[model samples]
Target: MLKKYILFFALIYILTGCGTDYMLSSFYLRKDFTWPTSPSEQKSLNYYKHVDGDLTKFNGYTSPSILATPANYLLVIYEIRDIPIYTKVYGVDGSSDMGVYVAISKNAETFSATPIRVGGIADDYGSPVSFVKGNRVVVLATGGIGFGNGKADEITKISVSISTNNGYNWTAWTNVIDTNIFKPLLAKANRFYTNPGNGTVLVNGTLVCMIDYKANGADTTPAGAAIIYSTDNGITWQLGSTLTYSGHRWARVIAERTDGKLLIAAVPNTTRNVDNIYNSNGALAWYMADSLNGNISSFQPSGLPNNSGGSIAGDRIQYSENGRSKSGILLLHSTPNRDYKNPGAGGATGKVKNAMSMSISSDEGQTWTLITNAIGQQEPYDKTSFRQSMKVLKDGSIVTCIEEGDKNVINDTSNQPFFIVYKRMGLSALSDGKYSYEGL
Candidate 1:
């Protein structure tokens, strides 16, 4: 029996170099394996003030985006509050100072000792999305003046920065899409703004990025997603179409299908309070866009749970399997499985959730099934895992980076610090051998 098992393992290793890893992972999953945490230095850090006027330090990371290249994996995160107090407590104007940083890894497991600062501002409203072709890498983020401070006439736009050398250094931030084009739309609303999204998908020689658009500063519900396109490999950009609705749409993400259709997923939030907008959105809204530009009618509720978490969808990847070529496009999603909104326990605002989950869909967003929980499903609520981004690598492996609350680093009962967690595994390993593919 021992020799038979050895021969079976050897045959798998001979068939695929990573096959043994997946088989072992599958066995471990049956045993309920514990996923490891990220390196200590990669966690985020910020300061908070106590009632007695003492300043204290905390650790946390948020809004992580990941990109895959031939030689390395790049992870971008909104890390470290450079300011003294929390944004929800004092406000967005003079209180919170968030910085954007990028960490590079030759292998997805180990990353740079210290991440390099990319872009950030006093009032950064959205996460960053990255695109890469050859040596040129582009990152787009939401930038504006005095956002969430309840001030009027505030301008918010999607800002872009380019790194010619693989995310090691980035240029000064500039608006990717000009707000002037939306002047007609802005005329109808008080403070028209755009926030960059989780990911972008390429279709028919164009890169389309789905962003959240707000008609006005005072409006409770968002104006739905605004599609932005780039025909020149993310060098230049323009606005395509703005999808509007009566309900609230938050944290919208997009991906392309094998048949050239685009799948958009957003957080369907019904909460009226501005403070709870980001805190709770129990379900995901799915929209099938027939084209890259328009034709999306309405987003229906998906089978995913009401996790109150920001959902991120990955771009599709075409791969071969069982010796066949160009088999299918694989799409992946990351979100917490349960609603994570509590008044004063989880994080600083107590608005986030834990138990980051990964779901897979091979049928172009038609159906989704949970593959695995990247973070432990039973972790404490304060051990938050939220706002993660994923990518399918050229090596048939999937890489992701998640923002998790550092349990040891506390800001207070209401809020906690966060850190970035980097994870990479073979798709077969992640699915417990349910899915496997050959790199194209």
Candidate 2:
């Protein structure tokens, strides 16, 4: 009876602003600190792990979406999990009380230790994507769907919440992107599950973001992604034609090129122990299209280097130096470096998600070169880094939040315990002496 009462009160605490009194400090680098000259040296500096500062408050954190607002503040939205709360609220096997929380930072270095929770609908499968336009920041999270009765079902709907003054407070959760748009493709109800991409890009005056959907429940194949856009500041959303490939594709990352083209990067929808046929070459799939509509069925293999098993994030930046006379479109993507299919020597041990690398393209993602092999400081094969999101700041610095955990349970998707690791460096630092950032 005592234990039961203790659990009840603990649930109440979490549901009603649990981290209000928490003051978790992050390890921040000095503003004037001299950055390293080599790419290897830059990758090893300024990495900080963040949670509620205590495992008891939040057990795990994953699916981080990092955004750089025009006001120069860095905002991150990620999924927070507490086992007891999840088991009770969700009442499903391997359930965890899942919620989307936003952490704010003035500079990339220091952050708000106590994060503000973005109220969710179902509060499960909270993979959030956030973007900013001026002071109005919008976050779209994957919720209002249930995975119970020993199977996953429901036409996954995205919950939209907005904050007028940055991310201090958010409005009530509302559904966006009508379900009728997907009715033609679904054979029956709950046949498709949708997850928001890493970030959204504002093109001209419209807001565009990628939404990846896959066959849910008993179905195993026939998955695709779409481009959803809004002109009235996220009041209403319209979906583009379905972008399908040969095999299942999801976890897309979108960016706007200097030429005003939309670049969508996606990966195969497969997990550990599943046969990975789509990513046999260790690269992310790419689709270059217009912001509004285009034939996305012609997605080809992106030469961008990656581990090819997890989510990826990227953005586009323009480079122009007055004296040097260098100008071009710069595309950057960050993902795990391991190739699951070609895990040499020790097989699975050689393919752990320990190293998160950043790949850069000078000619609008036509060709990419591996720039930095490590973004966050993690021991190879000892710590696991998975599911990362990044945004290039107005000052030309790149910031990322990595989902990392103990490598012992790398195969375990749930209850493995994870932390959101933050890292940032100038584009020049990550690129060595090759390129320097003038602005975004």
Candidate 3:
């Protein structure tokens, strides 16, 4: 009987060691630091606009969309060489044929000028979505829809380009999945994710690419969009059996968790009565999906019950809240305002403003908690000044690309969009609770 008791005690000890918080002491050190309110209150924000580049030049264009990889590298995609050259006005000389360009920055502030053009034909690439898996840098470009004098009758194809040399160079353009599968109206959308090699148990080690496809025959709603997944490293794809919502307009990003689940941040077109007739609306919903063996079993219900009035414009997901995890998944989304038609607000159409927000899930995305709200001030007056991208800093404070225009600052007067008109904010201020260093 004594031997049996001893064996039971040993088993208890082993179970305690396997608890989730078992390595908490070693991975995170608890510390007390006053959370900053504004950008100036935090020392980490000093890196904002610190890079000495010509913001007024096409080389350093502003308002470019950004994405960060698990390797802590920042990928910024924008029109290269000339910004004004791409801005077309009614099919005249509106700079519409500008090619998609990419730049890399290891430090998130000071970027290196290793620009790589991602399209073959003239002005074939625009509005790119990028992510990194293993040693490969994958980029998805929306084929010529908005460029040149193109009508809505034109069908847009989804083109893909990859960079194995870490943004140094790219392979020739390959039409991975022809957009014509949907028929009549096909457009290229944003964002894709893949699981870390050999980490997840559910997905069958296949590189999945979730794409946004609109069925124009189905009410012209963005929520009517459907998701498609690729199994063979984007070589072949199979459309998922589900639709995001009734009129889902845009899909900004799709992130796969360590447990083989997928999280997609999408925009539904229900907020404004005006349908996304021309596909110019921002995001409005952050949808989460649970996949088993590369097939989606369940997803967030229609209308996104958790999504508040704030629309999830564009965002990404991280495993560890502080960057300590090699696996697992945590959702990071940006919420600008709803662009529903508000009369006398400025123009005849109601405008959507930008604000930063976040959400977290501990159980591989089964349920989520709204951990943070808008980090920056409200831009009720100006629409341009707002947060664009969210970046997790080395110190755990979430850094975002704060552009001038909405409520903070004015857009750079230079003919070229001012690149330096960006800033960062601490994540703690955005968090609902006090800043906890336990996870850092």
Candidate 4:
């Protein structure tokens, strides 16, 4: 039995070497490597004040627009205070409610104190953002059940709230896109993509909203996740085609490049149970997809990089499945360690470390090359994880935020709910290397 088991393992390794390793090496290779300097040497800014409620916690803080401008500024929005966990069982009776608050930061680090409240909305969860375009500042939020009932079907709605006086005062909330319109046929069996998360961007003077929607049948199956665009500045929207893949996927961020192409990154939460048991034995993977002129190409290198040559551009173009001549889709996502059997468990047991992994595509979305895994230690829980928010600074330095400290649970007299127990991180120390920011 022992010999047979060894033989089986050897056979598996051989197959993986010929399959996974070959494909990965063809696309992904470590670039000029660097590491974060000492913690003290790292530059970062954190904003947290003890509000009236000891349970006041913020999650999903995002910028309204990826391309930052002085006149447009940056708008950060989040939910303040806590909700009862029991509300998940008893339903939203209005006894417990979460409020939405907004803060403007000119320098991305220092923020204004006066947080304006946007009324008529309930449970503004996930990454809610506000951006300025011409005369209007558009605020988009992910809608959750007003009460914490877990069963409530939350609709991903786009709310248009305009602010003329630099976000000082805002108009009433108006629903732009309803999730019901994009609901999949298998609604009950697959409901994860029911709500939207993260930030929104205005690409080429058109409003583009990216969201994660559920695909019915299996948990490991890929759902209907896509980017919806509105040419008339959020007045009307047209949904693009859904992505083609099988896994637990959610759209997180969108950015427009200098050449007027669209770049989108998504976090695919694939677990062992979902992968081995449900997803036909496929490993969990995070993906980045791109689209040129509303048509998605292959994945390419995201953000800026050193020595970005014709290879990066050409490979992404070649692998693009959408029949477009765009570059590759750059993928930056967190993956679990090998020792762990599942994603969530690995994350809990320090077996799932948050890593900043990258891939470059020259031919478009069809093929890709893996770049270096830059951030975090190899061991889980040993290195810090980059929060979903990432921005390219003026100095050409890549800036990403990490949640600092341990996880904590907040408790009221009657209920206890899990709240993110950490502070926001600013800039981190860059590893020793020659850095440049010519275009930025």
Candidate 5:
């Protein structure tokens, strides 16, 4: 009888070792698991990080957008449920799968309960953004295919929802533009394959957005980026003049420059290695575009080596405080760099060299200067931070939103899992990478 029992145990071990990752993950799910009582239980730091959009034992979150309004700061996130794929195999949420969500914060530190969630809309895959148009705020979000976040049929569309009360509440997502409207213009890439979304904004008060559509399901065979712009408060959108650059990733709307110049920053897809890390030649391009007219100029490099080139661009969010006087663009961006082993202890995940670095551009998208290299970088494999949103306070402090993880890989015991992390960087001591709200 003891021999029989031993034989059964051995069989179980062999099956677990040889079985598919999904099967193994399913087995583990059958075990007892507990969701964290809360994830924002961090010690006080001047710089802000996660605002309740974090990972729990059961649910995970991703894609953070930070918008500063007169009353309070609004942090919007796309919630992923059913915790699929990488999160499933080990374990996470689909920012793209769930429609839309928002969490409000008065000072970018403490957050209210998940205040707003809009559903039934497709293409929740892209980053959702908020902006003050007139008295109300508008949220622009996208959903796409190939995210593996469980959108049944290659969902591709950009949607708009409005909040009259500064993110305390929100309206349902209304599909602004779908793949069918833009597919005709993107025949160049054959189709927008694996066209995962990036960002949206009110460029120079004109709405500009990006949408990717694929021929088949997550085929990503020839990924494409379809660009669009609107002048009439997103009532209508214009298609790109040419569909050649469908391969641009992290395509985003930079603010309307004081000089009346509209810009778009993006990186070409071919600049990276098979591992999805940028090779030596990868470049992040900023294009001078029109908010009303699309693709006013070709995308060009910012004359800077955006190290590893995962930098995403956003509008020149204004902040006026303190006695210091400077006349230039205050461009806030989210950046990422290569991961590395610890120089001393050399842990498996290694010290995140600079996964979630922050850069500021006083030169109107021409160049970027690193402000903090230590805030959001976490774990090893460090591919977690990308295409996030940022907002600056009146006192020169900043709040940025991003998803943290090790790599975009899947493993049960893997160190990385997708969760939204909001970091605060102080204006006074950027060198130390501390969050000091002294001036504000």
Candidate 6:
């Protein structure tokens, strides 16, 4: 009877709040958690694992994403040379491409960048996200979708490469989605949008991937975060139905919850672009899909930036905890500040660009309680940090990899960087201000 009562109370404590420290009323507010006191304390909250802290013009790391391997390894795929899309490359006026690099770490503490080139065309192929089934490791990347004229040839086909011997070597190019699949879809559409930052997940014995495109011939017709999935080890794929959402802006991240539901997050602001980093409307809108091929729920606001109402900071990360006793979903996202024009009213309002935070959901993703200050205060109002990836180790320790760049004060605005940084901490460490990093 005593044991039963104890378990009941513990359940209540967890449901009421992840202990009393994370007690939140709206899940969109970041008022309760303990924040870092000083710059030193904030530094303690986020330290580095791998990075030289150099800042060059187009040389620093930009979009960093991660995946877990079969043998408990963290496979990180990010763009080297760290150049942005649709820029000059190799002295060409309109040539821009980045080399895709993969790093494998067995313990998530130490990492080594492999020499193998994950899928990439000479034109543009970066941002490779991985998925594993048994011993097979499949890497899915882009062929560079062009904009600002008629330069959308790369978006015609979805390129893929597979490896059975871990992160050693990759196979040749395999077009998962041929030109017939996407070319016809985009032929009629006047304004089309597609970025290389795609996401994938194995759902109900089928591998599902998210690709956003709108071919309604007008911007008025809401663009959809469409789906393309493979069931046979990525050897063959099908162009599934379009999953609709709130405001289909930029690339999205898809994560499966512990309850077997999938949440796809996208940038909801269509009027804004990269030129103006942070404007008035800056937040991530999410939609829950029963299946990638099934009907998607209506669009709604997410609890990402907390009360700060910050912009969609970077690529949002989602992970349902490992093991049989799956608790809930852990969503790691970022934002610059609540109100960029006017400072500090609510929604994590401050001048902290690329500022990171987390939202925990127990009942799938129906509601989220924001845990503010996971890696907070990147800078005073500039871009402190952006584009991060996380790995939930077998031992329940979640470690995140971050980029410290020109905006983050890694180096001055002159030199770029090739290295990214990782910090060692769990969810509780975010509120406690435990900023210390060890292990390369």
Judging by lDDT against the true structure, name the best candidate: 2
Give me the candidate number with maximum TM-score.
2
Candidate 2 C-alpha lDDT tens digits along 1-440: 99999999887677556453331222233331222224344433345556332344322566678876555567778876655331121211224456778888775666788898885444554667676766778777666443222345455556678888768888877877466765554543343334433556565667777665555553334356666777777767777656765544554545666777776776554532422421222456677776466655445544555554446777766553334633343333434435333234454444544356777666666666676665664443344555677776655566777765544224333444456777777666666555566545
Lowest lDDT sum, 10 consecutive residues, model 4, at 308-317
RMSD of every candidate to native, in Å, equals: 11.5, 11.9, 14.5, 20.2, 15.7, 14.5
lDDT of 5 by residue, 1-440 (tens): 99999999998887777877754775544431211111122113345455554333222554566666655444555445434433221111234245456677654556666546743443453345555655566666654433333544434445667767776666666766545655565343322321122234443566555544445433332344456666666555666543334555555555566666566666555332323432222556566765344445775535344433333545344322244433334344433344465434565443332255555555666666565555564333344454356655444555667655544331235434556666665544443422223221
lDDT of each: 0.53, 0.58, 0.42, 0.38, 0.48, 0.49
My TM-score estimates for the predictions, one after another, are: 0.70, 0.73, 0.56, 0.53, 0.65, 0.66
Candidate structures ordered by TM-score, highest first: 2, 1, 6, 5, 3, 4
Query: What lDDT is reached at residue 191 by model 4?
Result: 33
Residues 1-440, candidate 6: write the lDDT tens digits.
99999999988888676655455443523321221133333333333366323444443354556655666655666656444421221111123545566677655555774434675345555545456667777766644342222343434335677877666677775766565655545564322332333245544656665655544221333355566678887778676556555544443544665556566666544332332332223556676777656777754644555211121222223223332233445566664443332234343433544456665665666666676543532333334554565654333345566554444332223443434666544443553532221111
The alpha-carbon deviation from the true structure for residue 141 of candidate 5, after best TM-score superposition, in angstroms, is 3.0
Q: State residue 127's C-alpha deviation in candidate 4, in Å.
A: 3.8
Over 4 Å off, model 3:
1-47, 50-73, 79-95, 113-116, 146-154, 179-210, 215-223, 230-238, 242-244, 252-259, 270-288, 292-353, 363-387, 391-440
Model 2, TM vs. native: 0.73
Candidate 2: Cα lDDT at 358: 77
Q: Write the per-residue lDDT of candidate 3 for residues 236-343, one digit (tens) a residue.
A: 545554445544534433456555456655544433221121113343445555552234333542312322221233222333345454232334444445343334
Tens-place lDDT digits, model 4, residues 40-129: 433433233211122233222212222233453444444444443321211112244544565665544345666677545544433344
Residue 48 of candidate 5: its Cα lDDT?
A: 45
Q: Count the backbone clashes (under 3 Å) in each candidate.
A: 15, 2, 19, 39, 15, 13
